[model samples]
Target: EGYGLTEASPVTHCNPIYGRRKPCIGIPLPDTEARIVDLETGEKELPVGEIGELAVRGPQVMSGYWNMPEETEMVLKPDGWLLTGDIAKMDEDGYFYIVDRKKEMILSGGYNIYPREIEEVLYAHPKVKEVAAVGVPDEYKGEVPKVFIVLKEGETATEEEIIAYCRENLAKYKVPKYVEFRKELPKTMVGKILRRVLAEEERKKMAEAG
Candidate 1:
């Protein structure tokens, strides 16, 4: 249950991710519904068991974008539906789970790397304090997953050990191809991880090192 933007007016869909945190965002408050669709084709209205971009077309849907006609046309189709650029999947029980932001999908050797999947595994490790997974350039794969980690105070873990741990938990393709440790992580006033900024900084460092 985040802020309701123009695309999804009045905020109709949500999932209960956290417990005891400001009512319930997960379960729909009633009189609201949602759906999932394949972004590439937009033909398959995937079943609840599949993962796809979340699209909602109801009374709460937005009319159109502010001004940009092309941008508005790209999102709002002739069928009167707004394609929210959020990736999500619905459960058999009818609740929807937001996977990642649309633009955040990292393409690595034909694989889609979602940072949340990798970050979830990293967070489960006892020594890992905070982690952000990003895609870095790779000659063969086009791009590869890289993990930026911050350890808990008074704890220390080598990059190899961390990588090994991830290997044990994730698929070989899902495991981070690169690992970097830092004392503290950069954060904004609201404390959401700024991944794009970190990825850019890492690319800059690589350029300087070269």
Candidate 2:
């Protein structure tokens, strides 16, 4: 049960007690109209169950980003729709699911890969305590998913083992090409994984290697 933004007066949605999906952001709050639009254009509304950028309109939304007109215009449309950067989809029942951050999606061999989908598969493994999937540069594919995992206490796993497990659970292109074992992951005070920090580190290492 969650949905919020600095520009949306905070919460725009919440899961109800009777009908709710576990880990979902839930349905749009009262008076808030939500829609999923094309990720590239942000104009065409997508059909149900189709993943796209989430947009919302309501009284709670901010007028503009405090004189940052250009920045405000990018997200806050003239028609009162706020084009949220989050990738999401709506179910037939009207529940909303956050796919991942729009920028976090991977473009590999012309296929769109969502990091959250891969992370979900990794989380199913018994030894995994935490995991973050980031796109790394791949000469042939443009980019490939690289997973960094933190193992649970007293647990041990190998790169081959983890990759093999993923291969069995995910499509070939969606399988991570690289697996890194980390003692701990960078995070915010509230425990949100800092994936951008991990992406930066991967780029730095690749640059140095090149």
Candidate 3:
């Protein structure tokens, strides 16, 4: 699949008709330049295979948002690069892979954890029908991963079983610290899982508990 945004005239990168890598967004289109930059400052370009925010510049990119200078300036650099707010990396072959959205990243104990990485592992579990991994507030770690899951029909699973599965598949820092079984996960009208909503709920719950 390709990657683009409304700010970029909606099309930037795509897998070539041939030599396309599965699950990769492919290379930049002709005249479109894309780079992975340091997430903290968005200045230093990151090396290949390193995950960072994606920035792009091309003929198709927008000049500015209509009458929204502050918002426009936040994303559009004077040098013509548009910050995509997407975590991504490029391979040696020049194929671009989207890791996840920057806002949804979980900062747990100094490790950068992407919910998609955790969800992918949980999805592989035989009993898991759907899952959403989100960062919840943690006093000691600043934040930690907590997963909400919907089990497959007639399937049974325990929090310990799920945690053990993650412990086996993921690094210690990346494994979710909490598991909550649910009848269904919240979703957008288009059926995309609402991870932000889950995260907000978690924060609210922690606030109430304290």
Candidate 4:
């Protein structure tokens, strides 16, 4: 996923998944450079595998954050790093991993939950043809992982079975609290599953029930 920064300049990260594997943004392109900064102090680099705001500085980096000088100054550090608002981390293999869409990381009971992990487990089920995981508001846990699934043709896996599998493969905090079976997934033209769309539908149903 090549994220565009206005004109699509400046850095951060890019994801190029060639298959069903959890894709990583590979090394920089020609003349492009990037770094991961601690989300708090914005100084120093976290070891590979730690998540943080991705910053970049290279020929392709934008000059500023548009006309928002204050915002620009805040993002484009005096040291020439353009703090792309995206959150990510690099791997030991020098590949970048996006944590969330800045807006999508779920803060539930003081824990930051990323959806990709749960989605990965769901993908492991042979019966699951497709799935999407999203966060829904929860008054108790603050938020919870909810999964919407599309099973493979003639295949069967109950919602409880799916949750049990997740509990086996994931942390207690990471297992989805809700599950839904779908006939077909809402997808982008390019075939990307849109979790946000399913989340909206889940919200509508929850609202109706109330």
Instruction: Give me the candidate number with maximum TM-score.
Output: 3
On residues 1-210, what C-alpha lDDT tens digit does candidate 2 reach at each position?
A: 688998897899889868546679899989999999998889999999999999999999999988799999899899999998999999998889999998888999999899999999999999999999999999999999999999999999999999999999999999999999999999999999998999999999999999
lDDT, each prediction? 0.77, 0.94, 0.94, 0.77
lDDT, candidate 1, residue 119?
96
**Pairs that collide, model 2:** none
| RMSD of candidate 3 to true structure, Å | 1.2
Per-residue alpha-carbon lDDT of model 4 for 1-210, expressed as tens digits? 554365235434455445332466666555667778887777888888888877777766667755789877777778777776678888776677766665566677877777887888889888888888888978898789989898999988788999999999999999889898889988899998887887788679788988
Which regions in candidate 1 have their CA more than 4 angstroms from the true location?
1-3, 14-33, 205-210
TM-score of each: 0.85, 0.93, 0.96, 0.78
What digit string (tens of lDDT, one per residue) describes model 1 on residues 1-210? 642447777676554455533322354545555678896865569987687877666677777877788988877767766677878777766666778877677788887878899999999999988998888878899888998999998898988898899899998898888899987777889998888878898789878988
The best-first sequence of candidates by TM-score reads: 3, 2, 1, 4
Note the residue pairs that clash in candidate 4: 1-15, 10-61
RMSD, candidate 4, Å: 4.4
**Model 2 TM:** 0.93
Selected candidate, larger lDDT, 1 vs 3: 3
CA lDDT for candidate 3: 0.94
lDDT of 4 at 210: 85
TM-score of 1: 0.85
